[model samples]
Target chain A: MTSPLVTVTDLKVHFPIKKGILAKTVGHVYAVDGISFDIMPGETIGIVGESGCGKTTAGMAMVQLTPVTSGAVLWKGRDMAEMTRSELRALRREMQLIFQDPYSSLNPRMTVRQILSDPMDVHGLFTGHQRKERIDFLLDTVGLSPGQADLYPHEFSGGQRQRIGIARALALDPCLIIGDEPVSALDVSIQAQIINLLKRLKRDFNLSLIIISHDLAVVEYICDRIIVMYLGKIVEAADYASLYKNPRHPYTRTLMSAIPVPDPARRTRRIILKGDVPSPISPPDGCRFHTRCPDRMEICHKQEPAMRRFGNRHTAACHLYTDEQAEPVENKPKAKEKIS
Target chain B: MDQKTQASILSIQNLKTHFFSRKGVARAVDGVSFDLIPGQVLGIVGESGCGKSVTAQSVMGLVPNPPGKVVGGKIFFHHRDLLTLTVQELRKIRGAGIAMIFQEPMTSLNPVYTIGNQISEMFRLHKKLGKKQALAAAIDMLERVQIPSPHKRVHEYPHQLSGGMRQRAMIAMAMSCNPEILIADEPTTALDVTVQAQILDLMHRLKEEFSTAIQLITHDLGVIAEMADQVVVMYAGQVVEQARTVELFQHTLHPYTRGLLASIPVLGHRTLGKDEDLVEIKGMIPSLYDLPAGCRFSNRCPKVMDMCKNHLPDLIDMGGGHQVRCWLHTREMIS
Candidate 1:
């Protein structure tokens, strides 16, 4: 079997919390304490969580857009954390990130032609007429009119601006693209257009994608594998079918159940978890989700469960799957042991 | 299910709101109509620039002029046409009769004012209560919306509260006067799923307690399905379809509505793969200023016909209160 395109191992990103006029370090906000995942070539991996679950931080850390506090982001067997500036700069040409907000991502002053061609000029890919052709090709590739290359970013609509963003991401001819909340800002109709465009481009270019979004519907639709993050830790990771069909972790189940399905007639039972997510600065000891988890155990409060594998490449970090000898019957808890 | 028996708190008929810019007249809400019955959740679902918010604004008599005006239509709240009411008369009815909550709480709320001050102002102005009484009432309102430690939270500014708590404050302010109707425009769109669910559930509970009719305007069909009992599907500033939530989702008539239902990637079910493509409405929403002479959706509609290109179709009732604005349905009824 071929090797994976990217592998992230125990990646942690911590931001120091400062206090007073002296700006002394008080504590640290563990944005991404420790997470791990792998992205196979031509495969799409999605990381989903709420506002400050560190899904975005992990994604940024994977691409070296953010500084890693610990662990490694191995790009083709090379640890990116140890790479030199020039080496990392060269690595950036093969992997790129698309920001969430298209309204602010693109330069309002730059024309479409200039934005797409600027990257090529820096990389010294094509010169003269060849560069112009490549810019037009990138624009057309993202379903924008090549003739509109002369137009500024402001001249386009929200969806059109996103197309320009995709074009720019593809300008460097990268093999991997990490889109952070790519279609979240677009209208529903426009979201469908962009999702389709991304799918088409992924197949056509054989590009590995790591799409990070809070929208489960969009993630489930486009991604091959999914990682559920909570308070900077990965709770579950599985193939789309297995994850959606049979979510193992209590957090994963609650998150999946929370998403309102479009069909009104087919009403599914929902497990609405109460209370807000705990502050990441001081995440709950043991299992971070034990605070709001419905099927939590007494042991969950004292010990953090490691990632345990189920069948079909599905894995969940939960105490319910602790007993190895017990047959995982839909992976439900066996008994309610009283807390000491 | 007789419409006469079930009284409507707010009724809009052929509402045409246009934004008159220097370039042209942008018909934002073009001949749209809907009725919100008391205690019922009437969702108006559409994409951006589809006039769902404009319809809500029209009901509130809050359409900014010089650029926008309600060119034609009647917004009847409690059998009285709101358009004909004097500004002073509307002022009396604004919070007491009809209340509204906008999408962005940070922008909608006054930054300088404390949560208590902002909420108390509602009671002070509408209820004609004294300062101390209004402040006490505001704390009560905050507590009702499930804001923990209302006393402390009331003193805090909008920035001090989290997104969910801020929305709770907004809801508390809107419901302070016990208005008969509430127009919530994308109330939970800016929030996370957990918080969205919390707010949606809170709204549902509030509706049960107050029996206040809600005009929920959003682009999310999933939220609409979860909350709305009746739905209005709008396109290009026009009502393309209207029906019971279950009926509309089960048997969508308009091609545009069908495309919309097909386009969304639902959780727990996904058929679109590497080989298959998701169904998408072909083109962008037509320019509101230069809308199609016929059906506004004709340009992007996959099932477009020759008749759809030349003449606009009426929103004909197809029995059981399900209305569809399409030549195919209208032609079928005629035949």
Candidate 2:
């Protein structure tokens, strides 16, 4: 695919669980365990899962905000993990992150002007009069007036503050932007506005994005391709159209069914997962989703399924499609019987 | 679903909940009206600052005094005007007759108290039940909400339980007394999609078992479609549209309602192509502190008219219990 913009290979991030006065690492929470994906230039790749599925951690780990325990993250064919301190700082300008909470992300004490200018100053982008012009340009670019530069984050509403966050992310003209549930905290109406704005910014700047969110609908609207994660593992990955049309993994199907249909008259029965998500610190043996997967077989409980090609661009990790000799249950019979 | 059997458990007429702010009187809920039938689920959908939450709080008489006031209209619960009731009289009905489950379970729940204590306290205060009896009832309620190991879970603090479990516990506590009406404000907002489904299913079952009326306040169109029998779409502290859930989804007359429904990206083959622009309402929701004259949605409405900017559209019925307040709809009717 003509060399992808960002490639993540077998990335693992384990957070240490400390115990007692000595603070010895007794265990680890395997947040993102050996997950791999690639983001093409100017393509928006969505990473979606339920809360605590390590989607946010993966996004943070890519930006080096969180420490990666193992594996490689290559930015334009260069391994980010092996980069020197000075090199990483320069690379930070090319790859930026937009946090979830706009309220908490911004400095309450600093005015809008100071917040926008500080990033440029740190990077040594411009000086004096040029900085003022650049800040004004950024404010205008994000659809905010010049006068709003003097106002603090508290003075702005949730939507406006989010606009400032977006403006900050665009300060360095970053090639790849990782938005971690950027619009989840805003109102539905405001969320629409921000989503629309993000689309515009992406097109205008010719940027590649890795947007992480739990809301499937939000992902469906913006992302070109999507990767579905479950308990620190990639359950399914496909282009937007293929994944939504024909989800191969049972967990993916269940997740798709769970999204509430907006039309009341066209109400489809929801596929309720049997149990709560297992703790990431101690995930289940074999497939992590086997505990909640409706189409789980005996082999699924014992053998870990590898990601197998479903179609040209789609892949899924499930025993149902794997080559391990097992009689395939016909679709009609399974549809009749409630799996849960 | 017979009309005669469907008595309004809670009836609100011309309810105006205003907040006395430093700048001016913020009309949070301006002349809003609705009726909640017994054992029926009513969904109130609106963006933030649209006064859906305020309307729910006003019905419970939980609006903070001095700053906030129920300025006009009667809130009748079983034909009793709640506005006229004294504090003691209202307190008796708060937990026993009508209970409220807030959006954030962690904040709403008492951090110091165990789940068992919080649930049982409602019974002890209103029902005047003994500690032993109240504890038993609390456990039963917790089990009904599908909390695993109710015996063990009841003893755990709110912080100890997961987000989904905490929400379920909140629902259990609300339905502990088998109240006539349960007002849930964005109950599943903090929960994941799978957990959200479970919670909604539990709520649906609870309504059937207890024969309780539910006033669900949320911005999610999906939840409203699944849970609500009747839906009320609010804008800038006003009721823009009210209709049966099916009818509202099928034939949305109001521009705001249409915009909201269109904005939501549906699963399956329903989305209008990848390149199609989402029907986002152009402008932001008008600030409650300084709302414009006439229709608040007029600024964002695509089919806006000069008349819409000057005169507020009345909620007119278009047959079959479907009502909408929009200048474009009224104009089309007139022409």
Top of the candidates by lDDT: 1
Candidate 2 is scored at a TM of 0.94
Instruction: Report the C-alpha lDDT of model 1 over B36-108, residue by residue, as the tens digit.
Output: 8888999999999999999988888888987899999888877789999999999999888999998989999
Per residue, candidate 2 scores C-alpha lDDT tens digits across A110-150 of 99988988888889997878888888888898889988899
Error of 2 at B136 (Å): 2.1
Report clashes for each candidate as comma-separated counts: 0, 0
- What's the lDDT for residue A298 in model 1? 78
| Candidate 1 reference-contact recovery | 0.60
Model 2's CAPRI class? medium
| Candidate models: Cα lDDT each | 0.89, 0.88
Residue pair clashes in candidate 1: none
Give the DockQ-based CAPRI class for model 1: medium
TM-score of each: 0.95, 0.94
Of candidate 2 chain A, the 10-residue stretch with the lowest lDDT total is A331-340
